[model samples]
Target chain A: MSATDAEIYATRSFTETEVPMIELKGVSRRFAKKLDVAAKLARKLGADVKEEVVHAVDHVDLRVRKGEVVGLVGESGCGKSTLGRIVAGILPQSEGQVLWNGQDVATLPGEAARTAKLRRQMIFQDPYASLNPRMRVADIVGEAPQVHGLIKRGGFDEYVDEQMRRAGLDPAFKRRYPHQFSGGQRQRIGIARALAVQPEFIVCDEAVAALDVSIQAQILNLFMRLRRELDLTYLFISHDLGVVEHLSDRVVIMYLGRVVEEAPTERVFTAANHPYTRSLLDSVPRIGNRKRAFATVKGEIPSPLNPPSGCHFHPRCPLAFDRCKVEVPKLKAVDSLHRSACHLNDRA
Target chain B: MSAPTLEVRNLCTHFFTRAGVVKAVDDVSFTVDRGKVLGLVGESGSGKTVTGFSIMGLVDAPGRIVSGSILFQGKDLATLSEEEMRHLRGNRIAMIFQDPMMTLNPVLRIDTQMIETVLAHEKVSEDEARQRSRDALGMVGIPSPDERLKSYPHQFSGGMRQRVAIAIALLHRPELIVADEPTTALDVTIQGQILAEVQKLCATTGTAMIWITHDLSVVAGLADDIAVMYAGKVVEYGDVGEVLDKPLHPYTHGLIGSVPSRNKRGEPLRQIPGMTPSLLNLPEGCAFRARCPRAQADCVQRPELREWLPARLARCHHPHREEAAAA
Candidate 1:
């Protein structure tokens, strides 16, 4: 079968499942100005506010089913990291709700305490920055379990040893500091720390981007191995489409703080409906693939502070028309389980 | 064929330290034709950047061009005095750094930096220099070029700052420009735009360029010719398509195969084993022998970059052509 036909078949097979493990409904987060008490009182009394708010995470909707890895791909400062943070419940949403296993996360009493118990962990982009410089590998990996009270008294060392081994790290290296390890080794420690709490869901935010190509493969394979062994779910965020294609079961393409297209991995790769998605795929240089033409997208991404009035991608899109510039395109289904936010995809 | 625009012959750049000498660019040689782009691809510490620096006469104290000659337009730049080299630097040659901030001063406005650049090279009025600066900014696709000129470097975004730096380099219309990963930090869209602009400028003005980057994909699209650098030397040099399609050196083949895009999905990436050797303690004979998959006893003798084909060169005793043709 052709790649497109296989993609269609795969999309049709994905809708047999029910409700997702995690869902975000119209989630929007804006950062408020840091005002002093007197300034805050003045604003409360109807005084003029001078500071500007940053709309970091605009209205976004997404869902990740149980045991499925969802990849969120976008450039830096496109709100991929912000959305990931909101989904992980590390940051509070200014508007909208996050449903975790059919329950509103914000409504839960001591939400932080509850999420901590639920075992939703985030692996940061830079391993060097995420791992504490002064702390040894043993304490860095062991502290999560100690804080969550997962291990019994005097069993912390054994627990740390087990986690390190599970992450394919040498147990002896636990005594070494973060500075003593290479880029890949430090990332393994980061993974070991995340797994110590036995989290079912992980948010890997550009986990392997900072490492070399050889080291990247090692970490990616380690992640895959850990996932199968632990039955973990992942929300993988990265700018690299190649890495995402290798890891994700489903993929969401984001542009300027909003999702532009989302579908099963095969469908998105083979038959992307959105113009932006198609351009991005074409930009990736492939070896021994002479049939594919290079489609260089014109113009730079518009600044988020003053975005376009209608479709954010209309500025650089070659297929953009008057309708695209005036009306915001809502994401609609192009086929079963395949959705895109471009007006051209609006068959109706 | 016409003579190459810039011919680097046995160029060896070294850093003399208290411990020992660091052989950064050891006996590296290549040539670029007029209006052509030569991509120097390598991993960090491969000495690609140092080679570009050596050509521009930017090597600092304690680190100098210990031997060899850099012939630009038939003039040996290595033998020129500091004053003569300084005159040639911004006038006849230019360089774009990885970090735009390194090329730009945070305290100065865009117009001030660009106008000063023009006035330093030529006797021109401030208004004329400002006009030339505005044109340069517009050429690089910076919108509202005049308004952006009044703004400081800190005011521009990362990609925009890089565009401004590139624009500054283009003001003099130098015969050759050595760009050292200037677009590595930008997004793919911005990178594409910059590459297109650079290619257009080169084609229109008949200027030569050396684009030094580790990104093989960018080189595939932007470079006319490619030179794979390893252990402070060019292991292979040929047309971009020829080298990428049929790499002569084993190291070049491994480098191309290691990219994630080339491998099958879910398959383990093909990587060259072992880390880059220390420049201060390089092994004798072939620098890549430690990691080469096809290393043999004959590799113990150092191989020069001899012609494997017409206009193609490789420093490997066993080029891929013999094996493949024999098969």
Candidate 2:
């Protein structure tokens, strides 16, 4: 079955069953830098050189229900993008499993595997880099449907036309190349391409970060509209908290490759349970309120190669204590749904 | 009132590209009194940076200040020769760029760069210059200025690097400092700290400043006055509170409303439709008319920036005061 049909079927199934559309169980990925075998062997003999292993995504557990937009937020090297890639099945997890429709994506075979591929898609951060410069907008937008044979062989143009219309692009502009379109229009094409597959879940990795402030709003609204129209689920990853608060139904705040806090969007913004989340919230500049002093986190984000000892944020957390430095705090529920991995959750 | 320290009169800067002569800055005019911060705000390619560069006599070949005069302390800066302008550059006017590395050299130590900037403008002893550099670094909130001064640019974090760059700019204590989005790359806390230091410095030393940025929120907190730029023209100019609280131009209204902070949660963000017109092929009339909701037949004739009220200037034939009051 195609992604659109599967989405329709899932909506009907969801009316009776309560299974989440996607679930990630302790997914972690580590990448090793390229090195010669001789150099690797020499390093084992204490040759004053060490092989580097980047623990990009470390033991993240998350779940997204049907029609929910969950935001994954963190700084540049905090592994948010890596986790998004793992969830999209674009990169394999070194440890743990990904469940799509309660079936393990790693173990699925044939039609089930194909269905998993069609059910999820990703919208990359850079619209310019994501679209092919040499190809026409029609070919770029219709490639997914054409490759999957969802649309008939000769119906590529019509398929592209319909997707463009759905994405708020003029059909006549489909003949033009990606370079011919503006940044906002090009992002619309990227969204159209993702929607062409009719995926149940989409990972928007900093989707609007590259656009200007005004263009960013337009693109964000388009995403909101598409979510309502298609009943799609979104894993919105961004560094900007304002955008996250505007888009997310639930938010997962990450730091140094670990999920520090996860809560409903409104609660996370109003009464944050984690110090990092609080600091991130305070960092955003507001218009009317003048007296709110921003809490600038001291110390740079530690390199993932050598993260802080216990809680990764202990080095920079204002409320960090000796216990925070000695022992790792597992994510625990502070309330019914809000979860945070900080030792001082109850303390003022 | 004391004579305005920096008075700009009908400044126009144009770029001679292969396609045509692009009017990057058109008849822009504003004044900054001593010890005051005037913010120049606009989106990318809106020519805010070019205005700063033009005031510093930094506009190069194919791009020139076509008309108008830049009068700093009653002297015309546009008429100065290359040699005379070079002497005035770091001595009376200095600029802090968006990227700290643009002002700081990666190979040189922080102390070397800062000390040299001091010596470049004045005949000072090495020890005196070093002391001044240390003071400048300390002024910007870089902890342990002595130790930090010994390190290279790469040794510091991005925020710290920007601080070091800002410290270098402060070494000379110029009459005017043109900061072009210097803190846009910084985290809000660092940006706040820098903003505080910049404001304090301006107040203490009677230094006039032009802070160019795309973020209106930052300007709202820092600047005394603001000029909103669009398509290389000042769309609105007024006191910061007046301009922000009651923006008089359609472009200014769209910009202030479009920011994510201004809207409520869950609502679709308010956006000005259409992208900024390409400078290479600018429209003949009001540059914003193509995207403006209230465009009229009069908008086809380019409107000149005229004083709409006391110390308030707008380039719209029909400004937003009446609509704003009604709303």
Candidate 3:
């Protein structure tokens, strides 16, 4: 009933020995507020109006090898989705470099950049919001490929049908609009659209979080099946640790727009090194556990608009000491494949 | 034991729309003992919220409680007039909603809202009402209630705002509380904190609660009893531990099994096939027949909630025998 490590990893299309397919170095995205007319006038009057900058992602370093499923876990406004969008090139990072296939994607030549864009795709969280209500399933799924000249007009229907079949949708429903499909079916249409572009890597931002549990499972299975069949890699971003644990090869934990911890899924689940990661695991309600009580991590997630100095989590963390307030912890290796950012790790 | 605080018998609430009459809550029956929490677990459109609304007499014109006796402290809530029901509501029965804003006024300060709720229910002076509001906020783990009281609802975070809503609900010490997915919008830690506080309140004040949610694990932790609903009917009902450990109904079994945590990692989940039938046009027999694995031709007659074991009930044509379930 249980999968052995060898059995699980045997299905992996790529190994760690392979060079990273995508790498983010010092990736930081900042959003600056637009001042109102009054504020602009006040600033003109020498009131010393300081422009507020919301740091959505701060100096994050990440690597994803070919065919690896990296789960990004965090609470709301933790910059996980922003990070995902940055990877998929939908959003431009304010600073730092995004290297695709060890080459900087931004500096790539015109055609090369377009090629890179086609290789990496993003699947959004809400099926209803992302899909076009006016477009039929065929047009929605076939649009990208057709516009990009990947599929000829004559062969568009067949190509769309193939992508639909891969995504677990009946091709016969191609004529139906987004409104006609259920939540799961609409999500499949989204997936089919993404697959139509022939992507090698996908950044799924809370892909199944909106669906019911049963429908979620169906979608999760489809993702796994696609990964196996197409040798696809994913940067799967979700708030649900259970889903992340079920689907991820490695897990990355973020807090207030910073990478707090990174480890293989087993290591993160069994013995998390960071206090924030530990608390996130503790809060999940285990299905079969008879006793149901936990000391919840105190305090709400602080606003990302004005994140704390030094350690963002220190204010709410239980083991926070004086040193945690003044020093931003660098991610250091706790083990072979695990890295954690915490003041307590200094003792180790 | 003392009589159950709230007993609902054959409760059915239907929505009359231009399309057709939608039976949102169909012939549902359950009881919550004093100090006990009954978790009404179901997916969206399963009528768990309607059942809660029926108890609070909050179901609007389009929706009406057709037939059922909602016995609250030996009185029928279904028959109560709007005036009488309004008097009882927020006094002996309080309901919390999914969005804290549903219970909170966005423009008002926490203290003003809380004090008004208390004064409206009880004959209390302004100072005493304010003090009660402060105490209620403190009881739900909001820090510095006095300071929080002066702040507008917008100033509080999502978690804190929900706490304020919960505090207002508890100000009058209502005998029955119907919380409809109050913590669904919150983060896990915040949700755990609120659930812990609610559980403590029920234990300390002997308040009966009907906690309606789609999450089974949450129900397992918070509720003494659970009623798993499908297509407007409770397919299974029993003690939380007993029912979850050995769910008899196929729908309940499929639901529990579908949760990612229930399956070993890397393995496919034991998902129940097919989607829930539309509420407008449910199946002729058992509403769950379309998705139930054990469904047969004989499921045409809808099964009633009957005892499958001591203190346990399941509406199933083919419930798993104890031996069959063990394997």
Candidate 4:
């Protein structure tokens, strides 16, 4: 039942003429305020309840071509995960269009919707939290394919075994509970759960952030191997710039709720346009740049609820000018595929 | 060099669990010199944090230091009474945790906690203690120290709260500090600032430091010497540059090689195979044998930490030395 060597290392097929697998047009997600006990009491007493909103993702436009690995890099509260979820159809955007395979996923019919749901899956940051503790590894990975009717009623064990092997997990441990596995193994189990449904697109939201450095490498390798074997596309979201650079074909940098820069991996590293992007690259601790003075941004990330006027990065950007204060910088192409949102880039 | 600020030798700490004994830290040894930093680098469950706690005398029940010497100023801390350890701890020796909330009481104001920290160790007036607290905050780059001191822990940002904890640790001008992943929760920009301040403080005050973290990149710049821990053992130890640039042990080598910065974009990572062994039941011989590519039949017997090069030590039977490894 284990995956054959050929099956594990199957060559991925990509064509230049293929359309983007996922697209986000003017997407924004806003979460409403939750009332505390005091606030609830106040509302019961006829006191006005304030309406607070967290603009997690704002006016984002992204495209993921078939078999592409697009990295979405940002600090906490930058809406990287929210945007990823919106693309995966986990969260309905407050405003905008999420087109999957050139059609809006929201408008898909019953059969089409089920297929779309199975074709795209989400892999969370903490595998321990994502996996059900009560379920054995066998049920965790095998249940989805069965519910989706991808596997036969009696062929569950073989299908589960094959998925676990593809995810670098031993089929022998299928009977063990989620708690019985190590962090790396738990992550593999999560991946197996995702892969069992034969998904073509994955939204990996900090999937390797919780693992040890050595274990991080193992899981990252498995992810890369799976992409080739299954021809899967990924929207890899993480805060680690170096990791994003290592694993991605394109890198997109987000500040506040919007992407400040998007470019091919090499060009973004070599000749970055946005000041925020430059500082982010500089902030990373590299072995080659030993004892180099840290070029930290001036302040912490502003509250996404009341983000700054115009460019959200203008407050910390060293190159901020008068034009950056009143006018929001539009994403402009620096090269054919490289785009950056900055008033300075407009001047350049 | 003058006498080291702290020296740990043959340290073995274990936790008695229902399943079995967890050898959290076993026969680990290292030293931190005056005004220098020693980075204790490892992953979760690698015993890096336990080693710090053992030195600070902070390990709670179910965990005990079985045997070893934690020599601080030529004194064996392991043999010291709880009261004696207390006098040395927080006064001459301080520790910082990964979470700032672990050190700070959420209900207390910043000034009250810091003033108490200074007053607890020294015979100073309230005004003098407050002044010292302000100076400590300023030293760590907190803006408007007096104003910040008035606010509570919740009012300050995550990075600022950590800085406050560090300020309290520095109030007494402690000779040694053990910081366990203090910057792991902060953003990259904030992490940079904190690392700079800590490095500067060590230089100016002649305080030695043991920074425990899982991030190797942080150690590459911050530490004068590095100790790579694996399954509660000092698998490799030497100058940071020497150990990282030309690591002898396969584990250390693989760790550095796996980092994204080390690999070219789009190229498959040269990942070390297998996961870290469980502390409760590690593999026989070397705990890392299951993952190490160079493991041989010789590895069936445990290898002791030996000097592979001058001042550089490694615990491996077949280390990748520039010259042939001496048997």
Calculate each model's fnat, 2 decimals: 0.26, 0.41, 0.47, 0.59
Model 3 off-target regions past 4 Å?
Answer: A1-18, B323-327
Residue A164 miss distance in model 3 (angstroms) = 1.7
Better of 1 and 3 by TM-score: 3
- Give the per-residue lDDT digits (tens) of candidate 1, residues A271-315: 898988888887765544332234568877777767787888998
User: DockQ (Cα-based) per candidate?
Assistant: 0.38, 0.45, 0.61, 0.54
For each candidate, the alpha-carbon lDDT, in order, equals 0.84, 0.85, 0.88, 0.88
Model 3 DockQ reads 0.61
Please state how well chain A of candidate 1 matches the true chain A, as a TM-score: 0.89
Interface root-mean-square deviation for each candidate? 4.2, 4.6, 1.9, 4.0
Docking class of 1: acceptable
Best TM-score goes to which candidate?
3
- Which is the winner by TM-score between candidate 2 and candidate 3? 3
For candidate 1, give the lDDT of residue A227: 73
> Tens-digit lDDT track for model 1 on B26-93?
89988988998898998878899999999999999799999999999999999999999989898889
Candidate 1: where are CA atoms >4 Å away?
Answer: A1-17, A35-50, A107-118, A149-162, A165-168, A285-295, B280-292, B296-306, B309-311, B317-327
Report the C-alpha lDDT of model 3 over A21-59, residue by residue, as the tens digit: 899999999988989899999999999888788899999
Q: Which candidate model has the greater DockQ, 2 or 3?
A: 3
